[model samples]
Target: MTDPATLSAAEAARRIRDGRLSATALTEALLDRIATREPGIRAFVHLDPALALRQAEAVDRAAKAGRVGPLAGLAFGVKDVLDTADQPSQYGSPIWAGHRPRTDAACVALARRAGAVILGKTVTTEFATRHPGPTANPHNPGHTPGGSSSGSAAGAAAGFFHAGFGTQTAGSIIRPAAYCGAVGFKPSFGTLHRAGMKVMSESLDTIGIITRSVGDAAFAMAGLTGGDYGDPEARPGRAPRLGLCWGPTAEQAAPETREAIERVAAAAARAGAEIVPIEMPEPVAAGLAAHALVMNGESADALAWELDHAPALLSPGLRERMEWGRDQPRAAKEAGRAAFATARAAVASVMADVDAILTPSAPGEAPEGLGWTGDPAFNSLWTLLHLPCVTVPVGTGARGLPLGAQIVTAFGRDGEALAWAEWVRQAAVA
Candidate 1:
């Protein structure tokens, strides 16, 4: 049976506005489903039935008054890595098990303003890195769900909420969405306010969202996007030229991903959009490596105290990464940042001609087994330079798993990126 909890945010809002649904009933319905699915999925680190209902009741009351706003009565599951004043947001590590904040992150605040119920904090890999969380894929329990947004993707896939929020330091958002066969969006770097999200590597971390479809993703983003949260220089504007790059990514893509792109590209061609083939500078291939250096090295600095105080609290592999982060040379960090800047300039030249670039969101379908999460090599470049990006689900892979093609516009061109992604999404649908 298709669960009411599985409906998208837009659908939920429309139902509520028409008085066909009450926010309280929707919240309870989602909680019931979460209670059933969470035992195996372990998608949430925290759940507050009372608070969720309380918020829902407020929405219901508002609707009774005919005051329903754009997102009135919607619900969302958030990654534990993002701060939430109301819940115990443990960072998937035992060290901070009872941690709670006094305020919601900027993104959370935005959602609340739009009348979204804060369902609860979802699971995240320790500090949003490679350390595995308990989250498993919703499709097959034996397969690994990707991270560090494991819980957010899992929750959305399992119908726990209309949409969910996750952070992408290193494919945390896109990889998990692909693994869960859901649509995920990582807005261009710095577009979404990160005032309350937990800090990983300041250089690469991005706040992102996961939904059932690209249209849902755009709906969720419309509320949170604009200027740099409150910064004047962070303002959004017209989208730049769109450039298309596939070969650099295609060279190493899995067979399934290649086929999905071929199918999507052909479909897009039929829709009358220019599908150009272009090569990224040789340095982009190196961007992944550089991203690793910045992520590991900077992460070492952010969690140095944790590593020193509670090494046993983290997963074994993560502990080793900390040791590695501690020992990695200073030169790697310098070189990585320098290379990132250089690559940004090189990419800018291409951006001058095109409004955006369409690339594969992941290498292929989510792999089976639960040991390790999927790869983020394909997602590293844009994350590094903080470029605004959107993932358009083009089609399914060999196993019926979802596949995505990413649309990347220049940094801060989030509005344009979303529009182009919408255009591509509708074109494919047609």
Candidate 2:
């Protein structure tokens, strides 16, 4: 029989609400898939089948009692960086080996409020930084599944979970989602609550989700995004116009990757949306460098506790980066901020003609080896601008693997970006 876990959360919820399928059966199917794939995928850092089933059962019971919401009977996988009261929120570092939280992160609670079953936590790079996790791409285990939110995308792509939660400081969400061939959504900065989420770069970290379909990603955003927990900057609005640019950054993508995006752009243009390719004003490389600068400057504060004594427990990649950040002069941090401001201003000029911007989700498809997580060169600029971004799978790559495109919105216009993402995905499939 086909795996029930392969169905999107929105689809599964309908089946359950109509009594066409039991939530328990669906949860069992996912748990079984995870049982078979978890060993090889390592997508999950924690797994508790009993708890998941119990939650599913309760959801089914609630639905039977005429209680159901947008996510009734749906299951979700959260990243390790997000605190779960039931699961240990180890920051993927040995120093916090047994750490647990007494309260759920705001994002986790939001999922629960929507009646989602918390399947488990997925792997994240050490402290959601440069260190790669053990999770492999389901498409080709020989290759690396992108870093940080590695397991979340792998689980969704491998049919273990229909949808999973992830976060992006730089490319923790979109890069891995691209590499894994899944739909990744990073709403404009603070669109989703970040309370209880482990801090990487306070200014850059944003909550995101991964799913098999843009429709499902929208279903998730309908619930995952809201006003704010505490961040006053989280207010959101609508977006109408869209900015298009296929310049230096497009040139930067691997040849095959660029073609995939081109195919999608053509299809999008035919679908009645305006398509305008403009000059890529800001230096793409400079945005990446500034991201590194700020990331390094603030990382010391986030890792202060662990770095104080168990410095050796951190991964070499993270250790080296921390040390690099430690030595960075205050001037570099200021310069990075100044550079980000200039880029934001340039982005504003681009946004004037469009409601949002369209960009390639990744430089290329998932790379061949797992030695290093693929580059996040294409994603960091938007992250630095603190805008919302959603990755919609538009086509297969040169080798038949999935390829995705990024829908970037003006800062605080997350809803508009998501609407465009929905239209693009629908158009792509059509």
Candidate 3:
């Protein structure tokens, strides 16, 4: 039999349901893999092997009784920023260290009820802000795994879990998944409920999923929201009309990113996709700048208590940004919100001719150091506009690190986004 630890969530669930694999056996294989690789990866901040086994055992027993949820036998990691009753919901900060919630975050609760085993809580950046955590890229330990969804991406890539819950306030979900050579699906804003999450920027904080394959992301989303995100193997009836967009951040893209985008475009074209070279509308392009102002302003308010009472506990950089946010003129915040509103209203027309926009997922491959989490220039605009986005690893860069292509669709088109992402992935690999 294939190594159970490496199977995708969809495949694992199918195998378990088919009576070919037991949840307990799959969980044990993953635990064994983690025991050997976790020390160096540091992908998880909290892992209780016994608890994981207990969940898996219960799943196995439930299977015998013909009671199975859609996600049975699938093991997943929860980002630390999301509350988990069994594990500490430390938002990657010293101030909230060992913080536990009385109930699971909505996403976690839904996953658990759907029969997915909670493997552990993955590390997150402090307050899911600029400050990164200890997680290193699973591909190269010297490089970063990206943040603030660092551990979720690294864990999914390292086979520690089949899927992971990630949140994006900016590019947390897609950027990390790109850097770690995994698939990231940042659904339309509010597609997944955010109750019990440490939301830094309410406008931009979107819950997402990261997995080894686009199909796995679809599977996880179906279980989490009970939505028909479609099967990974199901291809669209016709080749999609994909807009090949360089976006406003094209100048900032490394050679690897540029090359990767062009390569994927060429491959997708050959596979019958209509690759249109489209320019972003002015209002939408302006949202890149607006994203920062809105994030900073909202984050300042979100962390006000922390800044007021335990200011010393906050990171120097975060404190400085929050202070700046606190002092910003009300007009500044309003202008930022206005920019987003304009962009969101204008984006529909921009996407009217294309099924989705094809862009770079990051500036380049994972950088050589873990200090910085690369740039979010390519991703922030879409996030600010409330678009659905997905990233799939296309190839490697000069540094042997992975590069990814992002597929973005209009708001409320998450299903289309996931389907198109799978198409792009197949085209790139074919």
Candidate 4:
């Protein structure tokens, strides 16, 4: 029999549905893998083996009763920032140690309804911000796993789960996945339900997923999307007509990242995609600062209680950011909102001629050391514009760490982003 942990979510679901694989057996395989690798990787913050077994057994029984949902036998890792009724959700902060919610986050509920076995809570950076987690890159423990959603990406890359839930406030999802060589999909803002998710920045926070392949990502997302929390404007359609952009930020990215982007574009063009080079508009470029301003401002207000009561427990980096946010003039926040609106409009106008935009996922591979997660300069602009973005691993960098390129679409065009991302992945490997 194939090692169940090695199978993709789509494959596991199909096998379970066909009765070729038992949920308990699959769950045990993954659990065993986790036990073996987790000590070195530290991908999870909370793991309940007995509970996972019980869920798998229940799924097996449900299958026998002909009551299985689409994801009947798949396993998933939930980011700690996401509330989980069955496990502790500490949000990677000492202040919230042992915190558990009364209910699952909306995305978690949807996965459970789809019959997925909840494996564990993956480690997250402090409050899903710059503060690093213990999760080391699965490819090389000496290097960092991109922060915020560090464990979700590391766990997926390590084959601990078929897929995992992650959230991106800035580059949380994309950066980590790029670092860990996993496929990260941050849907159009509000495409996935955010209810019960710890709010970092309401304007920038986006729920996403991490998987080994684009197909697995699509499979997981199909079941998790569509709830009262998602925007109605995010609709599915078409293969992408891509407009490639290597903006001013490109200069800051490593040559390897630039090479990855160029490779993906060439591959897409070879695959018959209409790829064109374009420049970033000035207003949209200004939105980068707007993104930081809005995120910091909102986060400070959101964590006012913690800032006031337990500031000592917060990481120095986070504390500084919160303090800065609190001191910012209200006019700065307003200017950020206006800047984002202008940038969003600029993006929309440009999209009239293309289905999606392509860019580098991060500056480069995951950096050495856990003290700092790589920069989010490449990702924040899109987050500010409220566009959908997917980072597909293209190849390895000079250090042999994974490299990725991003596919982005105007706000609410998540389907287009995913379609093009899958296309690019397919073309690259073809």
Candidate 5:
């Protein structure tokens, strides 16, 4: 029998609901796994064994009473930036250290309502920006696990949780997941509630999920959508018409990464999907540039209080970013906004002919250091376009590290993105 802690959320939930497995037993297994792995991975920042046990007991009670929810008896990790009433919501900066929110974030509340236990708070980068955390990759402890959602990705990969919360202003979710060998799904902008989440860039800070498989991701997305502050975009029904995209950034991808995309696309094509070659449009190319400005300016504004009051606590990289945002010319900011609108329209025009596009999840496998998270170059454009994307692991790289390929659907077509991703994953295995 598979270890209960190692089971995917979908499988674990089923067994718990059938009374084949008790929530208490499952939770104990997961907690034990975390205890064993947390020392080296440093994936969790705040873990309350008692709180998790209590939550598990509640789920067991509900299950025995025949009142199980979709995620009953499963555990999900929360990024430190997301508020947790019982845990400190320290946004990965010394300034907010030990700060606890009076209420859970909207997403957390929904997860609890669906019967999943909030396992712990995962480590995040400083303000979910350039600053790296102490988390090490679960695959290779010497290398980085990527950021700023490093811990959530590593935690999911290490089986500390079935699925975990992540956020991507750039490649925070995908890059980390790719590096850690997990499925990372970034829903269409505003698809998940962000009310109690730490804000970086309003335009690009999308809530996301990290899971072991696309099916688990789907289960989570199904339950997380339709919250008070969520974007209830209708998912289209049909086999996806996918376009193969390439650009200047594509050239920067490691040979292994490029090969992985080609392999996955070929497999999907052989499986009856239409694959068209598409170039990065000019406006979309320009929007990628604007992404940096929008993120920098907004991050500066969002963390202005800390910049002003706690200069000593701010990281050098973050301090520089804030200062640059503070000094940006009005024209630059406006140009970024204009560029975004144009690129958004251009991408939509092209999407009319296709359900989604295939792209690289990262530059390559996780880089060989813990000092920095790998580049977000491949993920920026789609994020800027507000498209929903899912990164599925297609194969391993030269070093045995996982390589992922992205499936990106038009804005508001999250279901298409996820469905196509699951298809591609299945095809790869076949």
Candidate 6:
């Protein structure tokens, strides 16, 4: 039998429902795996084995009673930025260390209610900003796992959890999942409620899921939002028309990323997908700059209390950025907002002829060293435009690090986005 710890969430759910595997057994396997692997990976900041087991036990009993929720038997890691009533949510800062919320974040509460066991709080960059945590890539400990969803992605890849809750202001979810060789699903803006989360950039922040497979991500989302994300394995009657968009970040892509895109395009073409080269509209391309301005400005405001009261506890890099954001001209911030509005309106035209856009999930592979997470140039445009984006591991880079291909669809088209991403995943493997 396959190791329960290594099973995808969809597979685990099926096994549990069929009485072939108990939720307790699966939870124990994951706990054992964490015990053996967590020291080197450092993917989690808080873990309560007893609590996890209790949840699993309850799930097992519910399954026996034929009253299981949609996510029964699945275990997930919550990003530290999200509130978890049972666990400390320090937001990766010493200032809020030992802080526990009175209620779970909406996403956490929904997941738990849907029968998913909370594994623990994963590390995040300070306030989900630039400063990274201690998490090292599971594939290469010497390399950095991308952030600020660092531990969520790493934990998903390391088998510590079947899925992870991640948020992306820029590329927090997709980039980290790419680096860690997992599937990242950043749905359309507001797809998942964000109440109780540490809000950074209100306009750009999006809650997402990180899973080992595209199907697992889709399954989790369907359970969480009660939306029809569709079956990942479902095939469309006609071949998909994919836009091969390099966007404005083409210049920033590493050779490996460029190669991965071309390789995936060719494979997709062979699989009957129409790969049409399309240029992003100027306004949408301009979102790269707008994203930076809006993110920094809003983040500064969001952390006003920390900046004023406990500035000493914040990281130097984050502190500097926050201070810069706090001092930005009001007009400059408004212009940035205008740019996003224009871009959001223009993106529809860009995708009018294509079912989805195929692009790079990150610059290349996970960069060496943990100090700087890789650039989010390839991902920010989509985030700013409020499009649905998903990344699947396509291949590996020169250093044996993983590389991923991003699939993006128009706003509110999450079901299609996930379906197309799964298609890309299948083509890459075929």
Q: Residue 387 of candidate 5: its Cα lDDT?
A: 89
Scored by CA lDDT, what does every candidate get? 0.78, 0.79, 0.92, 0.87, 0.86, 0.92
lDDT of 3 by residue, 137-232 (tens): 999999999998999999999888888999998999999999999999999999889998999887889999999998899888998888998885
Clash pairs, candidate 6, are none
**RMSD in Å for candidate 5, one decimal?**
3.0
Question: Candidate 1 lDDT, tens digit per residue, 216-300?
Answer: 6766776555232221123224323345577355677889887777666676677666677778877766765677778888888
Tell me the lDDT of candidate 2.
Answer: 0.79
lDDT of 1: 0.78
Give the alpha carbon lDDT tens digit for every residue of 1-430 in model 6: 7899888778789889899999999999999999999999999999999999999999999998998888998999999999999999999999998998999999999999999999999999999988889999999999999999999999999889988999999999999999999999999999889999999998899999999888888899989989998888887777799999898889989999999999999999999999999887788767677787789999999999999999999988888999999999989998999999999888788788899999999989999999999899888999989999999999899999999999999999999999999998899889
Total backbone collisions, model 6? 0
After superposition, the stretches of candidate 1 with alpha carbons farther than 4 Å from their true spots are 1-7, 15-20, 62-69, 225-244, 247-249
- Candidate 5 regions off by >4 Å? 226-240
* Model 6, position 213: C-alpha lDDT score: 87
The clash count of every prediction, one per candidate, is 11, 7, 0, 0, 0, 0
Estimated TM-score for each candidate: 0.89, 0.90, 0.98, 0.95, 0.95, 0.98
RMSD of model 4 against the true structure: 3.2
lDDT of 4 by residue, 40-141 (tens): 999999999999999999999999999878888799999999999999989999999988789999999999999999999999999999888899999999
Find the candidate with the highest lDDT and give its number: 6
- Which segments of model 4 are wrong by more than 4 Å? 226-240
In candidate 4, how many Å is residue 54 off?
0.7
- The window of 10 residues in a row where model 4 has the poorest summed lDDT is 227-236
Off by over 4 Å in 2: 1-3, 226-242, 246-251, 282-288
lDDT of 5 by residue, 28-107 (tens): 99999988889999999899999999999999998888899978888999999999998999999999989989999888
- TM-score between candidate 6 and the true structure: 0.98
TM-score of 3: 0.98
